[model samples]
Target: MRPPCDPSKFVAEIVKNVPPSGIRRFFDLVSGLEDVISLGVGEPDFITPWHIREMCIHSLEKGQTSYTSNYGLPELRDELSRTYYRRYGLDYDPASEILVTTGVSEAIDIALRAVVNPGDEVIVVQPAYVAYVPAVVLAGGKPVIVSTHRDDEFRLTAEVLKPAITSKTRAIVLNFPNNPTGAIMTREDLEDIADLVAEHDLLVISDEVYECLTYEGKHIPFSSLEGMKERTVMLNGFSKAYAMTGMRLGFAMAAPEIIRSMMMIHQYSMLCAPITAQIGALEALRNGNDEMERMVREYDRRRHFIVRGFNRIGLDCFTPKGAFYAFPYVGATGLSSSEFSERLLNEKRVVAIPGDVFGEAGEGFLRCAYAASMDDLKKAIDRMDEFVGGL
Candidate 1:
């Protein structure tokens, strides 16, 4: 009999060390259960605007099924360039500085792979998006985590970031309007960070995927900061703003050389983003502004309702200034984040992600996405109150 192949020997050590996404584990668990109210996923509850969907269908009918340029359709890039300039007062050469990818997720992966050298350190702020550390690891780099606190509204300041830098530090990952914790950095905050990055001569991967979703103040583009454009790779997409998550369209804006390097990786791995999706993205940029505004307004309404509801229920939720999630302190329930989440799911039939899944600092909190319907949100809150009362 042939000996069983040792899978451990064949699998790359780096790949093996990386854990599966914690967000998806709970998502999959709750997906199988009936009538469960889920606030676990950070996705928009709205569908893609009908015009955008129709544009995709129209493109398909017109035989626009062929692959786009490896860097993506030039027309789409032009629109992105114009939009960025108009929205954030930043200019990018559509031809050289922009490259479209499957999603902001892919933009992140390729950007890290393009810039990181083996053993180089990438400073990642926590609680960060789950993909950041693993993407750095896959690129043969070390992720130096700097935990941000709710006391400071989870903002990564120059003081917190400076201590994490070392001789080997090559880059910093900044995600404002951040996931899990919807914290945003003010202009002054970014100015401090920008000065630090300039002094250290470090590259920056700025994930502004939630830029358009900011509530309390305007979203600032990191690359737009003085002396930072050349050093920053800005990632954004249509997923959250246009409610086109499943369409998987995202873009990166950086210096020509950095974009060139990312394109080399993207071309080999992805070839091109789906042409139909590109067409839809193009339409979204052109005509989806009013719809985007409408969605944001609705989300704002829900945001206020949910934050108030959580605090009233004794969960002690800090007001989330951006993104669709509320990271409420669940420590009062005398349960660890996982225990609280699991028990809540099992007994209340309402799902919220355990915050520690985002980082160790997230242990006493739970991430509750407010993207569900008002009716569902109300129902979940009521059930959660009952659960907390029992505890």
Candidate 2:
């Protein structure tokens, strides 16, 4: 008889060493509970717009179920080409310059893999989305973490970013409006870093999935900066804006060569995004703006409400001008982020992600997502106040 196989040994040591996502453990806790107000998952509360869903259904009804080109549906890419030019004044060739992936997450992963050789250092700003660092490591790149501060509204200014770049630096990841903190980098702010990126001849993986939800001045594409377009891979998706998280459709726009490389990895790995999801995404790009804007207005309203609620209860929360999260400093409570989050879940039935999961800098903070019903937001705040009072 053949010896019992040890499939577990096939897992690389580095893969085994990578910690599980900090955001998911709380989600796991929330899943088993009843009457819990969760402020953890960074997803919109709105359902996918009716038209978008209708398009997906219509496509399936028409028997359009086969896999699309690895580069994604040409129609979607053509729409994307027109849309990017119209929205950002940046033109992308639909045939050679765009690649649709399973989601923005996959785009990020593939972009890193395509450009990052083993041991190359990729600058990752923190507190960042949970996936960024691990993605860098798995891509065989060393993650050089750059921490942004609350005083700067968590914007990664050139001053903080300069020190992180080294001779081995290969690329950098940019996300704004940022996750957890809801940070927005102004045009001048991006220009500051753009200069450094151009100076160093580095690459940028700009994750603009949250771009449409920006409530501040217009969102500027980092690729629009002079001399930066060729070095930038812009990742965006329908998940956040159209509330199509389940669809998992996202695209990357980049120089022809960069896009081709990413497409190679995507073709072999994911093959193509789901046909139905791409259909829904096509509808979103075509006509989902009205519903998207309506949802943004609601999120903006909740944004102000939740920030005010946290501030009123003595948690110092910076007003986030974009995205749907409020990062509140819970250090005054003398509880570590994990301690505070766990106790809040156990005693108060309120769920919040601990800042420590975002990175070490995220310690002593709680990321409370406002993408929930106002009723739930209010109740969660009350419970938080009670929890802190008892502490």
Candidate 3:
């Protein structure tokens, strides 16, 4: 008989070093509880628009279940190209510059792999999505974190970003309308960073999945900046904007060279994004604009209400200009972010994620997503108010 294999010894050091997702733990804890009002997960509460769903269903009925080309359906790529041109004045070749992946998650993974070499340093703005640093590490790269402050509306400016650069730095992962903070970079703000990128000759992976959900000014695509198109790999999808998170459809746009590099990794691993999801996404681009607009308007209303409510209850929350989260400082309650989140879950049956999970800079805040319904948001606020009063 063969000896039993030792799993721990066989695991890669990089995989072992990465911590489990902080968001997932809270989600699992809340799953078994009763009457828990959760504002922890960043997913939209809205279902995928009915018309998009119907299109997907129709495609399935027509037996369009075969795998698409490794790059993706040409029709979907063409739609994406047109959409980018219409929205951002950025033109990409549908045949060579676009590659669809399972989701933005996969796109990030492939983009990192394509650009990062061993010992390469990737600058990650803190209070970022949980995946960025891990993806960099998995690609055999080092992550250099630059913390953004609430005083700056959590925007990453060139001054703050400059000090972190080194000879080893190869790329920067930019996520505007950022997760956990809902911070959006203005055109002027991005110009500063673009100057640095030009000076350093660094690649940029721009995650714009939340592009459509900005409540303030229009979102400026980083690739739209002068000279940035050649260096940027733009990643976006149907998840947040269309409430199609489960559909797992996302695409990357870059110069042909970068897209081809990313495609090699994707073809070996994922082969292609789901055809049904691709069909749905195509419909979303073609006809779901009004429904997408309606969802954004509703999210804006909830954003205002939640920010106002948090301030009224003595939790100092900065009003976010984009995305669906409110990052409120929880220090006034005399508890660390984790402590507050724990007590809120155990004592009040409300769920909110600790800010520090994103990075050390997130310590004093808790990320409260406003993607839930108005009723749930109100209930969560009331419970939180009572909890704060007792504290």
Candidate 4:
């Protein structure tokens, strides 16, 4: 008989330090509760538009069910290339510089794995998406977090970036129209980052999945900077903008050499994104802009409703300029982020993610995703107001 396996031997050392994603726990807990209003998940509540859905069905009916090229279908790549150029004024060779991945999440993973070596240092701005640190660790790198203050709109400045850099630094992971915080980087901010990155020769793994969601200003691609194109790996997707999150279609754009290496990883890891998703993404790029704009406008309206509601209820929320989240300070409640969320959930049936779930910098706050119906938003506000008033 084979010897009994040791449980300790089965788990990797890296897995021990990485905590479970805090975002997922709230999602799982809320999903089981009946009549619970959830603003926990940072996903567009809208359905994939009819035309985009039709494209996927049409492709499936046409027997386009087989695996695509590991780099992705050429048609999708061509359209995505055109879309990026048209929208951001950044030129990328579809054939040599783009690799379609399962989602922007996967693109981030691929980029991290492709560039980072053991003990390499990657600078991450927090409060950020939960995936960045773990992705770095899985790539055999150390994540050096730079805390961005809520008071400053969560902008990651060169001042913060300076101390995080050392000789071991390999890259900086930038996720703007940031998760939880909803902050965006301006052109001036990108220019400053370009100067530092150029001096340090640092690679920028830019996650711009929420590019289309900015409310106050235009989305500026970090890759659009003069000296940044060759150094930036852009991660974009059909999820938030097209409401195609379930389709799991996203792509990465980088220099030819970087794309070649990422393609090799993609070939071994995922092979390719679903052929159906590729088709849907292609149609989304071709025709989904108008739909995206409509949704963005809707989100903007909902954003104001949520923020103004919170203010009226005595919970002062910082109005977000990008993404569909509002980070509100919950200090008056005399509860920690987790405590406040739990109390609100049990007492009011209103579910929102605790900001600390994003990182320590996210403490003293709560993240409310404004991706629900207006009625739902109003109901949630009422519930929260009642709960807070009793405090």
Candidate 5:
């Protein structure tokens, strides 16, 4: 005799509603296909620098394998405090104001859950990362999408953001050098948003994970603005800058009350980030900037290479100011983004994400992440030429 087969009780409605990450789904499909060239993933191609890897090894050797404090190891928190002020001009008391999470990815989730109540609204700017909407849904908040225009370089302007606010609005998620589009917000843009948040008294989740990868100008943390530090939870990590994605560590800085509140949720959801990874990230914060500079310089070179190649090949692409993606307008191809992407991959073996994955506004574009090798990028460009020529 077997127990009753009511496995549906084991599944959550929230998990069922969450679609697979659109970027990763394409990567998986193209994985075993012969002669595939992928520009689809958002991870850096660089290996974690040897010194950071050594520090993790040292931590493990010293029996630093125990679980850290829910908020994270204090020394690492202090290092993050120093690094935050030193790098971004944002000051936070690491002990009371920071909560380390698995990655900025989780930092986004927990912070949103802490702030948003059921039926509250969370404003998401597009074309944004794929995570924000689902996180908002799981937290029982409604997602109010604010479209950012390509003609305006896809920035989240104050003009674009203000009208979307209402009495039920709980928070706004800000990402820059943003994912998919690689557009960054300017200081003026931050000031306007800050003024809005101040007027409406809204919380902010500012994701600046690509702060170290900007090419056109400096990366400005929205939390660094005058009144925003109190209202904004700054989420960032070593993944993009140090090529330490697999290390699975990130930190959030906010008002002490907000941090304390989120910590309770973090304590339950995840005990703490991996002890070994925290050790490596702390070392990266203290000593890895030189390596970061080299990587940014290399990415800058690849940025120019991809943008120029796309322009020469008849794709209308704006120069990305931050992050390692090239969002090129593919409207002239006379195909929808899905059709174009599928045809390109199947015909030319070149992989890129259809921009609609970011949002409906992204329909006429394709996001080609340049975080692959220079040779791979060059090969992708060659394949693009061959594919477009056939059209």
Candidate 6:
């Protein structure tokens, strides 16, 4: 005589222990509403450019729907090898070191599962992507959070990171041009931590999905630093850069042994990234740069406009140098992050995610994505002005 829907009876302990994504919950509130200008999710507003979609269509017309090799399409991996080398001057073998994942999401999951032993400690920097900490917990590792401060421009420094290390610490997850904060770590910023990673012999799981969207500085791959490539599992994806989120393609690069380990989990769990998507991704790498840059330029414009608008409306907003988000301090409204977001939605119909959803360190801020149309951005800003002015 158990209750009808008891979590303890039906769910795994870890599954029950971890709460559902706070971002997802906010999105759910907006789902039934009409004319909502949602800045909640961190997804691009651009469509996959014509050529990438055309390639997917061409694949389907050619009956190319079969499962790809468990590792991924070889040709796609080859193209990725060329792309990374051309951009970062880093070399990863197409055969043994590169893995095309279902998305960067799956890449993270498999990589964590492959490396984490039960109770091993993994460092997750906050305010972090919603996925990182949960992914670590699900992989059987204890997540050790290191909060990055707004005063540091949200950069994680070696001096701040040194005290967090211990013998149980197995790895650290690094995301630059980060979501929520839209913060980027420059080469000097990253080099400081690279030295620490080297000193402690810690592994790095670097998610550089937003690398192409960097505005103020050149993007530097963590693996490019001396003595770090062998210890880093680097992940990048088409979803962010190419605006191909629906296609669900991403790739991971690491040493041969690590690649093999991740591939085993991937084979059993996902088998392969879709064959049609692989063909599309290959086409994207070959010809999508200009279109991608165009989108980035537009985002750059919207970024400035929204940030200025937020500041003018009396919110102290940090100007983000990369990605398409503006993190505005909403404490001026005298509300908790959730309270501010709920009140805004109920009163203004504009959707900015409550920053505490990202992490506890994010409680006083609101993540406003600039990925919306300029018209929407303008109206959202105007509405925000009214909302704050009334308060």
Number of clashes recorded per candidate: 0, 1, 0, 0, 0, 0
Q: How many backbone clashes does candidate 5 have?
A: 0
Question: Please, what are the lDDT tens digits per residue for candidate 5 over residues 1-391?
Answer: 9787888889998778776676666766687899888898789999999999999998788898999999999999999888878877778998899999999989999999899899999999988899999999998889999999889899888898999999999999989998999998888888888999999999899999999988877778888888888989989998999999998989999999999989999999898999999999889988998999999999999999999999999999999999999999998989899889989998999989999999887888999999999889999999999889889
- Which sections of candidate 1 miss by over 4 Å? 1-3, 24-28
Candidate 5 runs further than 4 Å off: 1-6, 23-28
TM-score against truth, every candidate: 0.98, 0.97, 0.98, 0.97, 0.97, 0.97
Rate residue 146 of model 4 by lDDT. 91
- The digit string of per-residue lDDT tens for model 2 on 201-281 reads 899999999999898788888999988999899999988999999889899999999999998999999999999999898
Give me the overall lDDT of model 4: 0.90
Clash-forming residue pairs, model 5: none
Ten residues in sequence with the least summed lDDT for candidate 6? 2-11
| lDDT score for residue 295 of model 3 | 99
- Model 1 lDDT tens row, 297-353: 999999999999999999999899999989999987889999999999999999998
Give lDDT tens digits, candidate 6, residues 1-391.
9657755677789987675788667767887888888777578999999999998998899899899898899999899899889998999999999999999999999889989999999999988888999999999999998988889888888877889999999999998888889999978878889898988889999999999999997988899998899999999899988888988999899999999999999998899999888999999899998999999999999988988998898999888998888999998789999999998998999999898998998999999988888888998998889999898
75-189 per-residue lDDT for model 3 (tens digits): 9999999999998889999999999999999999999999999999999999999999999999999999999998999999998999999999999999999998999997888
Q: Residue 149 in candidate 4 has what lDDT?
A: 86
With a 3 Å backbone cut-off (N, CA, C), the pairs that clash in candidate 1 are none
Cα distance off (Å), candidate 5, residue 207: 0.6
CA lDDT of 16 in candidate 6? 72
Report the backbone clash tally of model 6.
0
What is the model-wide C-alpha lDDT for candidate 1?
A: 0.93
Q: Lowest summed lDDT over 10 consecutive residues: which window, candidate 2? A: 22-31
Cα lDDT computed for each candidate against the true fold: 0.93, 0.91, 0.94, 0.90, 0.91, 0.90
Give the worst 10-residue stretch by lDDT in candidate 1: 23-32
